[model samples]
Target: MQNASHRIRVYQASDCPELTRLDVSKLGRAYHKIPKIISTKFDSIEARLGIFFLKKYRLNALLSNLTFDIDYHCKNAQIFSTPYGSIGFDINRKFLLSILHTYYGLSKEGNTVSLDLTQSVTKTEDRLKIKLGQELLQLTMVKEVLNETLELKNDYTSIIHQWPYSVRFWLEGYDEYCFSILLDAHHVDLLLATSRVDSESDEPKAKNLSSEQIEHMFNNMPLTLTGRLVSINLTVAQLLNIGPGDIIPVSLNEPLPVFIENEQIFSSVVAEERGRLYLSEFNDKTPEMKYE
Candidate 1:
Protein backbone atom coordinates (compact mmCIF):
# COMPACT_ATOMS: atom_id res chain seq x y z
CA MET A 1 0.00 0.00 0.00
CA GLN A 2 1.15 3.61 -0.71
CA ASN A 3 2.26 5.74 2.22
CA ALA A 4 -0.58 7.99 3.36
CA SER A 5 1.78 9.83 5.75
CA HIS A 6 3.38 11.73 2.80
CA ARG A 7 0.03 12.88 1.32
CA ILE A 8 -1.31 16.30 2.24
CA ARG A 9 -4.87 17.54 1.63
CA VAL A 10 -4.97 20.28 -1.05
CA TYR A 11 -7.92 22.67 -1.45
CA GLN A 12 -9.63 23.61 -4.73
CA ALA A 13 -11.37 26.82 -5.85
CA SER A 14 -14.85 25.52 -4.98
CA ASP A 15 -13.79 24.84 -1.40
CA CYS A 16 -12.56 28.46 -0.90
CA PRO A 17 -14.76 31.54 -1.41
CA GLU A 18 -11.79 33.97 -1.56
CA LEU A 19 -10.12 31.98 -4.36
CA THR A 20 -13.24 32.07 -6.58
CA ARG A 21 -13.42 35.88 -6.75
CA LEU A 22 -9.70 36.43 -7.53
CA ASP A 23 -8.84 38.74 -10.45
CA VAL A 24 -5.74 40.17 -12.13
CA SER A 25 -6.65 43.77 -11.16
CA LYS A 26 -5.77 43.02 -7.55
CA LEU A 27 -2.05 42.94 -8.48
CA GLY A 28 -0.08 46.17 -7.89
CA ARG A 29 1.06 48.53 -10.66
CA ALA A 30 4.61 47.24 -11.14
CA TYR A 31 5.27 43.87 -12.78
CA HIS A 32 8.12 43.14 -10.31
CA LYS A 33 5.69 43.43 -7.37
CA ILE A 34 3.61 40.42 -8.42
CA PRO A 35 5.99 37.96 -6.71
CA LYS A 36 5.11 39.39 -3.28
CA ILE A 37 1.33 38.84 -3.74
CA ILE A 38 1.60 35.40 -5.35
CA SER A 39 0.69 33.32 -2.29
CA THR A 40 -1.68 35.87 -0.73
CA LYS A 41 -5.24 34.97 0.25
CA PHE A 42 -6.79 37.72 -1.91
CA ASP A 43 -5.50 36.28 -5.24
CA SER A 44 -5.93 32.78 -6.67
CA ILE A 45 -3.04 30.78 -8.07
CA GLU A 46 -4.61 30.69 -11.53
CA ALA A 47 -5.14 34.47 -11.58
CA ARG A 48 -1.55 35.23 -10.64
CA LEU A 49 -0.21 32.75 -13.21
CA GLY A 50 -2.52 34.15 -15.87
CA ILE A 51 -1.18 37.67 -15.32
CA PHE A 52 2.39 36.39 -15.28
CA PHE A 53 2.02 34.37 -18.48
CA LEU A 54 0.18 37.22 -20.16
CA LYS A 55 2.74 39.86 -19.28
CA LYS A 56 5.69 37.64 -20.15
CA TYR A 57 4.53 36.00 -23.39
CA ARG A 58 1.47 38.10 -24.32
CA LEU A 59 -0.42 34.80 -24.72
CA ASN A 60 -3.98 34.23 -23.54
CA ALA A 61 -3.19 31.02 -21.65
CA LEU A 62 -6.27 29.69 -19.90
CA LEU A 63 -5.46 28.30 -16.44
CA SER A 64 -8.11 27.00 -14.08
CA ASN A 65 -8.28 25.93 -10.41
CA LEU A 66 -4.51 26.14 -9.92
CA THR A 67 -2.94 24.66 -6.79
CA PHE A 68 0.52 23.91 -5.40
CA ASP A 69 1.97 21.49 -2.82
CA ILE A 70 5.32 21.63 -1.09
CA ASP A 71 7.50 18.54 -1.38
CA TYR A 72 10.47 17.72 0.84
CA HIS A 73 13.17 15.29 -0.20
CA CYS A 74 16.17 13.65 1.50
CA LYS A 75 19.76 14.40 0.51
CA ASN A 76 20.79 12.46 -2.58
CA ALA A 77 23.91 12.24 -4.80
CA GLN A 78 22.10 13.43 -7.95
CA ILE A 79 19.54 15.92 -6.64
CA PHE A 80 19.46 18.56 -3.88
CA SER A 81 17.06 17.67 -1.03
CA THR A 82 15.87 21.18 -0.27
CA PRO A 83 12.16 21.73 0.25
CA TYR A 84 10.52 22.90 -2.96
CA GLY A 85 7.00 23.65 -4.18
CA SER A 86 5.05 22.40 -7.25
CA ILE A 87 2.07 24.16 -8.84
CA GLY A 88 -0.52 22.49 -11.09
CA PHE A 89 -2.94 24.07 -13.57
CA ASP A 90 -5.71 22.76 -15.81
CA ILE A 91 -4.32 23.94 -19.13
CA ASN A 92 -6.43 24.43 -22.24
CA ARG A 93 -5.63 21.14 -24.00
CA LYS A 94 -6.83 22.44 -27.38
CA PHE A 95 -4.49 25.43 -27.31
CA LEU A 96 -1.46 23.24 -26.56
CA LEU A 97 -2.44 20.74 -29.30
CA SER A 98 -2.69 23.55 -31.85
CA ILE A 99 0.90 24.64 -31.17
CA LEU A 100 2.33 21.14 -31.81
CA HIS A 101 0.19 20.85 -34.91
CA THR A 102 1.50 24.11 -36.38
CA TYR A 103 5.20 23.82 -35.55
CA TYR A 104 6.35 20.12 -35.55
CA GLY A 105 3.42 19.20 -37.81
CA LEU A 106 2.39 16.56 -35.29
CA SER A 107 -1.15 15.24 -35.08
CA LYS A 108 -3.50 17.00 -32.65
CA GLU A 109 -5.17 13.71 -31.59
CA GLY A 110 -2.70 12.87 -28.78
CA ASN A 111 -3.17 14.65 -25.44
CA THR A 112 0.48 14.34 -24.33
CA VAL A 113 4.05 14.61 -25.69
CA SER A 114 7.55 14.01 -24.37
CA LEU A 115 9.73 16.95 -23.17
CA ASP A 116 13.33 17.44 -21.98
CA LEU A 117 14.18 19.43 -18.85
CA THR A 118 17.77 20.64 -18.52
CA GLN A 119 19.06 21.85 -15.16
CA SER A 120 22.24 23.84 -14.50
CA VAL A 121 24.44 22.44 -11.73
CA THR A 122 26.67 24.42 -9.37
CA LYS A 123 28.88 21.73 -7.79
CA THR A 124 32.68 21.79 -7.82
CA GLU A 125 32.65 19.47 -10.85
CA ASP A 126 30.41 21.90 -12.77
CA ARG A 127 28.03 19.31 -14.11
CA LEU A 128 24.32 19.29 -15.09
CA LYS A 129 21.63 16.87 -16.28
CA ILE A 130 18.64 16.69 -18.68
CA LYS A 131 15.62 14.59 -17.78
CA LEU A 132 12.63 13.49 -19.82
CA GLY A 133 8.94 13.79 -18.97
CA GLN A 134 5.71 13.07 -20.86
CA GLU A 135 3.52 16.20 -20.86
CA LEU A 136 6.03 18.61 -19.33
CA LEU A 137 8.59 17.95 -22.05
CA GLN A 138 6.70 20.36 -24.27
CA LEU A 139 8.17 23.15 -22.11
CA THR A 140 11.46 22.80 -24.01
CA MET A 141 9.54 24.39 -26.85
CA VAL A 142 8.61 27.29 -24.57
CA LYS A 143 11.25 29.53 -26.19
CA GLU A 144 9.84 28.73 -29.60
CA VAL A 145 6.33 29.19 -28.31
CA LEU A 146 7.22 32.58 -26.85
CA ASN A 147 8.64 33.63 -30.21
CA GLU A 148 5.56 32.41 -32.09
CA THR A 149 3.24 33.68 -29.38
CA LEU A 150 4.63 37.19 -29.73
CA GLU A 151 4.77 36.88 -33.53
CA LEU A 152 8.44 37.86 -33.45
CA LYS A 153 11.83 36.20 -34.08
CA ASN A 154 13.31 36.98 -30.67
CA ASP A 155 15.34 34.25 -28.94
CA TYR A 156 14.05 34.05 -25.35
CA THR A 157 15.95 30.91 -24.33
CA SER A 158 18.83 32.91 -22.87
CA ILE A 159 16.44 34.96 -20.75
CA ILE A 160 14.53 31.91 -19.45
CA HIS A 161 17.73 30.03 -18.57
CA GLN A 162 18.92 32.87 -16.31
CA TRP A 163 16.48 32.07 -13.47
CA PRO A 164 18.53 30.18 -10.87
CA TYR A 165 15.86 28.55 -8.75
CA SER A 166 13.26 25.79 -8.67
CA VAL A 167 9.95 26.16 -10.51
CA ARG A 168 7.53 23.41 -11.53
CA PHE A 169 4.59 23.63 -13.93
CA TRP A 170 1.97 20.93 -14.07
CA LEU A 171 -0.72 20.55 -16.73
CA GLU A 172 -4.07 18.68 -16.88
CA GLY A 173 -4.28 19.01 -13.08
CA TYR A 174 -2.04 16.00 -12.63
CA ASP A 175 1.20 15.76 -10.62
CA GLU A 176 2.51 12.85 -12.70
CA TYR A 177 2.48 14.96 -15.89
CA CYS A 178 4.65 17.93 -14.99
CA PHE A 179 7.67 19.86 -16.30
CA SER A 180 10.30 21.09 -13.86
CA ILE A 181 13.65 22.93 -14.08
CA LEU A 182 16.20 24.07 -11.49
CA LEU A 183 18.61 26.99 -11.78
CA ASP A 184 21.67 26.95 -9.55
CA ALA A 185 23.98 29.81 -8.51
CA HIS A 186 25.82 29.76 -11.83
CA HIS A 187 22.66 30.55 -13.71
CA VAL A 188 21.97 33.56 -11.50
CA ASP A 189 25.38 34.96 -12.36
CA LEU A 190 24.50 34.97 -16.05
CA LEU A 191 21.42 37.11 -15.40
CA LEU A 192 23.32 39.67 -13.31
CA ALA A 193 26.40 39.75 -15.55
CA THR A 194 25.31 42.84 -17.51
CA SER A 195 24.10 44.84 -14.52
CA ARG A 196 27.31 46.79 -13.87
CA VAL A 197 28.08 49.88 -15.96
CA ASP A 198 31.63 50.37 -17.25
CA SER A 199 33.39 53.52 -16.12
CA GLU A 200 34.88 55.94 -18.70
CA SER A 201 38.29 57.65 -18.42
CA ASP A 202 38.31 61.38 -17.48
CA GLU A 203 41.49 62.30 -19.40
CA PRO A 204 41.00 64.02 -22.75
CA LYS A 205 42.51 62.68 -25.99
CA ALA A 206 44.70 64.68 -28.40
CA LYS A 207 42.65 66.14 -31.20
CA ASN A 208 43.87 66.92 -34.73
CA LEU A 209 43.72 70.61 -35.71
CA SER A 210 41.51 71.48 -38.68
CA SER A 211 42.56 73.78 -41.52
CA GLU A 212 40.16 76.49 -40.33
CA GLN A 213 41.57 76.44 -36.80
CA ILE A 214 45.18 76.68 -38.08
CA GLU A 215 44.22 79.60 -40.33
CA HIS A 216 42.52 81.45 -37.44
CA MET A 217 45.63 81.07 -35.23
CA PHE A 218 47.92 82.33 -37.98
CA ASN A 219 45.67 85.37 -38.74
CA ASN A 220 45.63 86.53 -35.10
CA MET A 221 49.47 86.58 -34.73
CA PRO A 222 51.12 90.05 -34.60
CA LEU A 223 54.31 90.89 -36.60
CA THR A 224 56.56 93.85 -35.69
CA LEU A 225 59.79 95.18 -37.21
CA THR A 226 62.07 98.15 -36.40
CA GLY A 227 64.22 99.88 -39.08
CA ARG A 228 67.16 101.67 -37.45
CA LEU A 229 70.84 101.69 -38.62
CA VAL A 230 72.52 103.89 -35.98
CA SER A 231 71.66 105.87 -32.80
CA ILE A 232 73.11 109.43 -32.66
CA ASN A 233 74.58 110.17 -29.22
CA LEU A 234 73.49 113.76 -28.39
CA THR A 235 73.93 115.69 -25.14
CA VAL A 236 70.94 117.07 -23.28
CA ALA A 237 71.63 120.69 -24.47
CA GLN A 238 71.89 119.52 -28.15
CA LEU A 239 68.55 117.61 -27.91
CA LEU A 240 66.76 120.61 -26.24
CA ASN A 241 68.11 123.22 -28.77
CA ILE A 242 66.94 121.13 -31.77
CA GLY A 243 64.11 122.66 -33.86
CA PRO A 244 62.18 121.90 -37.06
CA GLY A 245 64.19 121.49 -40.39
CA ASP A 246 67.31 120.56 -38.35
CA ILE A 247 69.40 118.16 -40.40
CA ILE A 248 71.41 115.67 -38.29
CA PRO A 249 74.10 114.30 -40.63
CA VAL A 250 74.63 110.52 -40.91
CA SER A 251 76.39 108.14 -43.35
CA LEU A 252 73.96 107.09 -46.15
CA ASN A 253 76.29 104.20 -47.16
CA GLU A 254 75.49 102.28 -43.92
CA PRO A 255 72.80 99.57 -44.36
CA LEU A 256 69.62 99.91 -42.15
CA PRO A 257 69.13 97.06 -39.69
CA VAL A 258 65.63 95.59 -39.42
CA PHE A 259 64.71 94.18 -35.99
CA ILE A 260 61.67 91.92 -35.95
CA GLU A 261 60.13 91.72 -32.49
CA ASN A 262 63.28 93.37 -30.93
CA GLU A 263 65.62 90.81 -32.65
CA GLN A 264 67.89 92.00 -35.47
CA ILE A 265 67.13 89.52 -38.34
CA PHE A 266 67.89 91.33 -41.60
CA SER A 267 69.62 94.44 -42.98
CA SER A 268 68.17 96.60 -45.76
CA VAL A 269 69.35 99.73 -47.70
CA VAL A 270 67.31 102.90 -47.06
CA ALA A 271 65.57 104.36 -50.16
CA GLU A 272 63.43 107.44 -50.76
CA GLU A 273 60.47 107.54 -53.15
CA ARG A 274 58.13 110.56 -53.45
CA GLY A 275 59.52 111.93 -50.13
CA ARG A 276 58.46 108.68 -48.27
CA LEU A 277 60.99 106.38 -46.60
CA TYR A 278 61.10 102.75 -47.86
CA LEU A 279 63.31 99.67 -47.32
CA SER A 280 65.04 98.16 -50.41
CA GLU A 281 67.86 95.70 -51.26
CA PHE A 282 67.12 93.37 -48.31
CA ASN A 283 69.99 91.06 -47.19
CA ASP A 284 70.40 88.45 -44.42
CA LYS A 285 73.10 90.32 -42.40
CA THR A 286 73.36 90.50 -38.56
CA PRO A 287 73.95 94.00 -37.18
CA GLU A 288 77.12 94.40 -35.07
CA MET A 289 75.60 97.15 -32.86
CA LYS A 290 73.34 96.14 -29.94
CA TYR A 291 70.10 97.99 -29.06
CA GLU A 292 69.44 99.18 -25.47
Candidate 2:
Protein backbone atom coordinates (compact mmCIF):
# COMPACT_ATOMS: atom_id res chain seq x y z
CA MET A 1 0.00 0.00 0.00
CA GLN A 2 0.99 3.66 -0.21
CA ASN A 3 1.82 3.74 3.51
CA ALA A 4 0.47 7.21 4.12
CA SER A 5 -1.02 7.21 7.59
CA HIS A 6 -3.56 9.92 8.36
CA ARG A 7 -3.17 12.02 11.50
CA ILE A 8 -6.44 13.24 13.01
CA ARG A 9 -5.68 16.30 15.14
CA VAL A 10 -8.79 17.27 17.04
CA TYR A 11 -7.93 20.58 18.60
CA GLN A 12 -9.27 21.26 22.11
CA ALA A 13 -8.62 24.25 24.27
CA SER A 14 -4.98 24.38 25.38
CA ASP A 15 -4.07 24.24 29.07
CA CYS A 16 -4.69 27.82 30.11
CA PRO A 17 -2.18 27.48 32.96
CA GLU A 18 0.58 26.24 30.67
CA LEU A 19 -0.15 28.93 28.06
CA THR A 20 0.00 31.58 30.78
CA ARG A 21 3.35 30.24 32.05
CA LEU A 22 5.09 29.59 28.68
CA ASP A 23 6.16 32.50 26.49
CA VAL A 24 4.66 32.39 22.98
CA SER A 25 7.90 33.68 21.41
CA LYS A 26 9.81 30.90 23.18
CA LEU A 27 7.46 28.38 21.55
CA GLY A 28 8.38 30.08 18.25
CA ARG A 29 5.45 32.45 18.41
CA ALA A 30 1.84 31.37 18.95
CA TYR A 31 0.30 29.98 15.75
CA HIS A 32 -3.39 29.28 15.63
CA LYS A 33 -3.83 30.61 19.19
CA ILE A 34 -7.47 29.92 18.37
CA PRO A 35 -7.88 26.17 17.90
CA LYS A 36 -5.75 24.62 15.10
CA ILE A 37 -4.23 25.04 11.68
CA ILE A 38 -5.63 22.40 9.36
CA SER A 39 -3.46 22.32 6.18
CA THR A 40 -1.73 25.55 5.30
CA LYS A 41 1.98 24.99 4.46
CA PHE A 42 1.05 22.98 1.40
CA ASP A 43 -2.51 23.63 0.28
CA SER A 44 -4.68 20.59 0.98
CA ILE A 45 -4.66 18.71 -2.35
CA GLU A 46 -8.48 18.44 -2.18
CA ALA A 47 -9.69 20.95 -4.76
CA ARG A 48 -7.84 19.48 -7.74
CA LEU A 49 -8.10 15.87 -6.59
CA GLY A 50 -11.32 16.14 -4.48
CA ILE A 51 -13.96 15.74 -7.17
CA PHE A 52 -12.19 12.72 -8.56
CA PHE A 53 -11.72 11.28 -5.07
CA LEU A 54 -15.21 12.18 -3.79
CA LYS A 55 -17.17 10.89 -6.81
CA LYS A 56 -14.91 7.89 -6.98
CA TYR A 57 -15.75 7.26 -3.31
CA ARG A 58 -17.44 9.31 -0.51
CA LEU A 59 -18.23 12.85 0.62
CA ASN A 60 -16.98 15.50 3.12
CA ALA A 61 -17.31 19.14 4.22
CA LEU A 62 -16.85 22.26 2.05
CA LEU A 63 -13.58 23.15 0.25
CA SER A 64 -12.52 25.71 2.90
CA ASN A 65 -13.14 23.19 5.66
CA LEU A 66 -9.46 22.21 5.33
CA THR A 67 -7.12 24.44 7.33
CA PHE A 68 -3.40 25.03 7.03
CA ASP A 69 -1.02 23.19 9.32
CA ILE A 70 0.64 26.48 10.20
CA ASP A 71 2.76 25.42 13.18
CA TYR A 72 4.32 22.38 11.50
CA HIS A 73 5.29 24.42 8.47
CA CYS A 74 6.61 27.49 10.29
CA LYS A 75 8.78 25.29 12.50
CA ASN A 76 9.97 22.47 10.20
CA ALA A 77 10.83 24.67 7.22
CA GLN A 78 13.59 27.24 7.51
CA ILE A 79 15.45 29.95 5.64
CA PHE A 80 18.59 28.24 4.34
CA SER A 81 21.68 29.29 2.39
CA THR A 82 24.74 27.19 1.59
CA PRO A 83 27.89 27.23 -0.50
CA TYR A 84 25.81 25.02 -2.78
CA GLY A 85 23.07 27.66 -3.17
CA SER A 86 20.43 29.79 -1.49
CA ILE A 87 16.66 29.31 -1.21
CA GLY A 88 13.63 30.70 0.60
CA PHE A 89 10.04 29.44 0.86
CA ASP A 90 8.01 32.62 1.17
CA ILE A 91 4.79 30.62 1.16
CA ASN A 92 4.69 26.94 2.12
CA ARG A 93 8.45 26.21 1.70
CA LYS A 94 10.40 24.75 -1.17
CA PHE A 95 13.92 23.24 -1.16
CA LEU A 96 16.93 23.71 -3.43
CA LEU A 97 20.36 22.25 -4.25
CA SER A 98 23.05 24.60 -2.98
CA ILE A 99 25.76 23.89 -5.61
CA LEU A 100 28.23 26.30 -4.07
CA HIS A 101 31.62 26.49 -5.78
CA THR A 102 34.50 25.00 -3.73
CA TYR A 103 31.90 23.63 -1.29
CA TYR A 104 32.01 19.96 -0.39
CA GLY A 105 28.64 18.46 -1.43
CA LEU A 106 26.69 16.93 -4.28
CA SER A 107 26.27 19.25 -7.25
CA LYS A 108 22.83 20.13 -8.57
CA GLU A 109 23.92 19.29 -12.13
CA GLY A 110 24.26 15.68 -11.04
CA ASN A 111 21.89 13.49 -9.00
CA THR A 112 18.75 13.36 -11.15
CA VAL A 113 15.73 11.00 -11.39
CA SER A 114 14.88 9.13 -14.57
CA LEU A 115 11.21 8.81 -15.43
CA ASP A 116 10.33 5.40 -16.80
CA LEU A 117 7.03 6.24 -18.41
CA THR A 118 6.87 2.75 -19.94
CA GLN A 119 6.05 1.45 -16.48
CA SER A 120 2.58 2.62 -15.52
CA VAL A 121 2.41 4.84 -12.41
CA THR A 122 -1.40 4.79 -12.05
CA LYS A 123 -1.12 1.94 -9.58
CA THR A 124 1.55 3.88 -7.69
CA GLU A 125 -0.54 7.03 -7.71
CA ASP A 126 -3.65 5.21 -6.55
CA ARG A 127 -1.79 3.58 -3.71
CA LEU A 128 -0.23 6.89 -2.72
CA LYS A 129 -3.62 8.63 -2.75
CA ILE A 130 -5.10 5.79 -0.72
CA LYS A 131 -2.30 5.66 1.82
CA LEU A 132 -2.20 9.43 2.15
CA GLY A 133 -5.94 9.59 1.62
CA GLN A 134 -6.43 12.31 4.19
CA GLU A 135 -3.82 14.48 2.49
CA LEU A 136 -5.51 14.00 -0.87
CA LEU A 137 -8.90 14.41 0.74
CA GLN A 138 -7.61 17.49 2.51
CA LEU A 139 -6.58 18.85 -0.86
CA THR A 140 -9.98 18.10 -2.34
CA MET A 141 -11.89 19.41 0.67
CA VAL A 142 -9.78 22.54 0.70
CA LYS A 143 -9.91 23.05 -3.06
CA GLU A 144 -6.10 23.20 -3.25
CA VAL A 145 -3.42 20.96 -4.74
CA LEU A 146 0.26 20.71 -3.97
CA ASN A 147 2.35 22.30 -6.71
CA GLU A 148 3.78 19.01 -7.96
CA THR A 149 5.09 20.52 -11.19
CA LEU A 150 7.63 22.96 -9.83
CA GLU A 151 10.47 23.90 -12.15
CA LEU A 152 12.81 20.92 -12.51
CA LYS A 153 16.48 21.97 -12.14
CA ASN A 154 17.36 19.49 -14.85
CA ASP A 155 15.41 18.01 -17.74
CA TYR A 156 12.33 16.16 -16.46
CA THR A 157 9.31 14.26 -17.75
CA SER A 158 6.04 13.03 -16.20
CA ILE A 159 5.30 9.32 -16.27
CA ILE A 160 3.51 6.66 -14.23
CA HIS A 161 5.83 4.03 -12.85
CA GLN A 162 5.43 0.82 -10.79
CA TRP A 163 4.18 2.93 -7.85
CA PRO A 164 5.41 5.30 -5.20
CA TYR A 165 7.27 7.40 -7.75
CA SER A 166 9.24 9.43 -5.28
CA VAL A 167 12.05 11.85 -6.17
CA ARG A 168 13.95 14.66 -4.52
CA PHE A 169 13.45 17.72 -6.72
CA TRP A 170 16.71 19.73 -6.51
CA LEU A 171 16.14 23.23 -7.73
CA GLU A 172 19.09 25.39 -8.86
CA GLY A 173 17.79 28.17 -11.09
CA TYR A 174 14.84 28.55 -8.73
CA ASP A 175 14.64 28.94 -4.96
CA GLU A 176 12.97 26.68 -2.35
CA TYR A 177 12.98 23.92 -4.99
CA CYS A 178 14.16 20.90 -3.08
CA PHE A 179 11.38 18.60 -1.87
CA SER A 180 10.38 14.95 -2.28
CA ILE A 181 7.23 13.38 -3.85
CA LEU A 182 6.37 9.79 -4.60
CA LEU A 183 3.62 7.16 -4.32
CA ASP A 184 3.83 6.78 -0.56
CA ALA A 185 6.44 7.43 2.11
CA HIS A 186 6.92 3.64 2.10
CA HIS A 187 7.63 2.96 -1.59
CA VAL A 188 10.52 5.39 -1.45
CA ASP A 189 11.89 2.98 1.10
CA LEU A 190 12.11 0.08 -1.35
CA LEU A 191 13.98 1.91 -4.05
CA LEU A 192 15.30 -0.34 -6.81
CA ALA A 193 18.66 0.24 -8.53
CA THR A 194 19.77 3.81 -7.91
CA SER A 195 22.26 5.89 -9.90
CA ARG A 196 24.83 7.84 -7.97
CA VAL A 197 24.15 11.51 -7.38
CA ASP A 198 27.38 12.14 -9.25
CA SER A 199 28.49 9.70 -11.92
CA GLU A 200 32.04 11.09 -12.08
CA SER A 201 32.68 9.44 -15.43
CA ASP A 202 29.50 9.04 -17.45
CA GLU A 203 25.96 9.69 -16.29
CA PRO A 204 22.64 9.89 -18.10
CA LYS A 205 20.41 12.96 -17.86
CA ALA A 206 16.63 13.51 -17.74
CA LYS A 207 14.75 13.89 -14.48
CA ASN A 208 11.77 12.38 -16.30
CA LEU A 209 10.69 10.58 -19.50
CA SER A 210 8.07 8.03 -20.69
CA SER A 211 8.34 4.23 -20.99
CA GLU A 212 8.81 4.26 -24.74
CA GLN A 213 11.82 6.54 -24.50
CA ILE A 214 13.44 4.49 -21.78
CA GLU A 215 12.74 1.25 -23.63
CA HIS A 216 13.87 2.58 -26.97
CA MET A 217 17.30 3.48 -25.57
CA PHE A 218 17.54 0.45 -23.32
CA ASN A 219 16.98 -1.91 -26.27
CA ASN A 220 19.09 -0.11 -28.82
CA MET A 221 22.21 0.54 -26.78
CA PRO A 222 25.22 -1.74 -27.28
CA LEU A 223 26.12 -3.96 -24.32
CA THR A 224 29.68 -2.77 -23.83
CA LEU A 225 31.43 -5.06 -21.36
CA THR A 226 31.75 -2.86 -18.23
CA GLY A 227 34.75 -4.75 -16.84
CA ARG A 228 37.10 -2.83 -19.15
CA LEU A 229 39.53 -0.72 -17.15
CA VAL A 230 41.46 1.42 -19.59
CA SER A 231 43.41 3.78 -17.39
CA ILE A 232 44.24 4.64 -13.78
CA ASN A 233 44.23 8.36 -13.10
CA LEU A 234 46.66 10.05 -10.70
CA THR A 235 47.08 13.63 -9.64
CA VAL A 236 49.84 15.95 -10.98
CA ALA A 237 51.41 16.07 -7.52
CA GLN A 238 52.10 12.33 -7.73
CA LEU A 239 53.82 12.70 -11.07
CA LEU A 240 55.94 15.72 -10.05
CA ASN A 241 57.25 13.87 -6.97
CA ILE A 242 58.92 11.26 -9.21
CA GLY A 243 62.78 11.68 -9.05
CA PRO A 244 64.97 10.80 -12.06
CA GLY A 245 62.59 8.25 -13.68
CA ASP A 246 60.91 6.33 -10.92
CA ILE A 247 59.13 3.16 -12.05
CA ILE A 248 55.58 3.45 -10.74
CA PRO A 249 54.75 -0.23 -10.50
CA VAL A 250 51.33 -1.76 -11.02
CA SER A 251 49.93 -5.06 -9.73
CA LEU A 252 49.44 -7.35 -12.78
CA ASN A 253 52.58 -7.97 -14.90
CA GLU A 254 50.97 -10.27 -17.51
CA PRO A 255 51.64 -9.63 -21.19
CA LEU A 256 47.89 -9.17 -21.71
CA PRO A 257 47.21 -7.08 -18.64
CA VAL A 258 44.04 -5.32 -19.81
CA PHE A 259 41.75 -5.30 -16.79
CA ILE A 260 38.01 -5.92 -16.94
CA GLU A 261 37.06 -4.48 -13.59
CA ASN A 262 39.63 -6.57 -11.66
CA GLU A 263 40.30 -9.66 -13.74
CA GLN A 264 43.12 -9.49 -16.33
CA ILE A 265 41.95 -9.72 -19.94
CA PHE A 266 43.81 -8.88 -23.21
CA SER A 267 47.46 -8.18 -22.32
CA SER A 268 49.47 -5.47 -24.07
CA VAL A 269 52.70 -3.63 -23.36
CA VAL A 270 53.38 0.09 -23.21
CA ALA A 271 55.19 1.07 -26.46
CA GLU A 272 55.63 4.78 -27.09
CA GLU A 273 57.32 6.01 -30.30
CA ARG A 274 55.78 9.43 -31.15
CA GLY A 275 54.03 9.91 -27.80
CA ARG A 276 51.23 7.45 -28.73
CA LEU A 277 50.30 4.02 -27.36
CA TYR A 278 50.17 0.77 -29.37
CA LEU A 279 48.77 -2.48 -27.96
CA SER A 280 50.28 -5.75 -29.28
CA GLU A 281 49.47 -9.43 -28.63
CA PHE A 282 46.14 -8.75 -26.95
CA ASN A 283 45.00 -12.00 -25.23
CA ASP A 284 47.58 -13.77 -27.36
CA LYS A 285 48.53 -17.10 -25.82
CA THR A 286 50.27 -18.67 -28.82
CA PRO A 287 51.44 -15.38 -30.37
CA GLU A 288 52.20 -11.90 -29.07
CA MET A 289 49.27 -9.54 -29.63
CA LYS A 290 50.67 -6.60 -31.60
CA TYR A 291 49.32 -3.13 -32.41
CA GLU A 292 48.66 -1.79 -35.93
Model 1 regions lying over 4 Å from their true place: 1-207, 210-222, 241-247, 273-275, 287-292
Worst 10 residues of 2 by lDDT: 187-196
True-vs-predicted CA distance for residue 210, candidate 2, Å: 27
Give a tens-digit lDDT track for model 2, residues 196-225.
122222766667978998899798664322
TM-score of each: 0.22, 0.17
State the displacement of the C-alpha of residue 44, model 2, in Å, after optimal TM-score superposition: 20
lDDT of 1 by residue, 34-151 (tens): 2222223223444544564456434444433223222212122123211221111122223333333334435336645543223232241122111112122223212211111111
Q: What residue runs in model 2 are displaced by over 4 Å at the alpha carbon?
A: 1-130, 133-221, 227-292
- Estimate the TM-score for candidate 2: 0.17
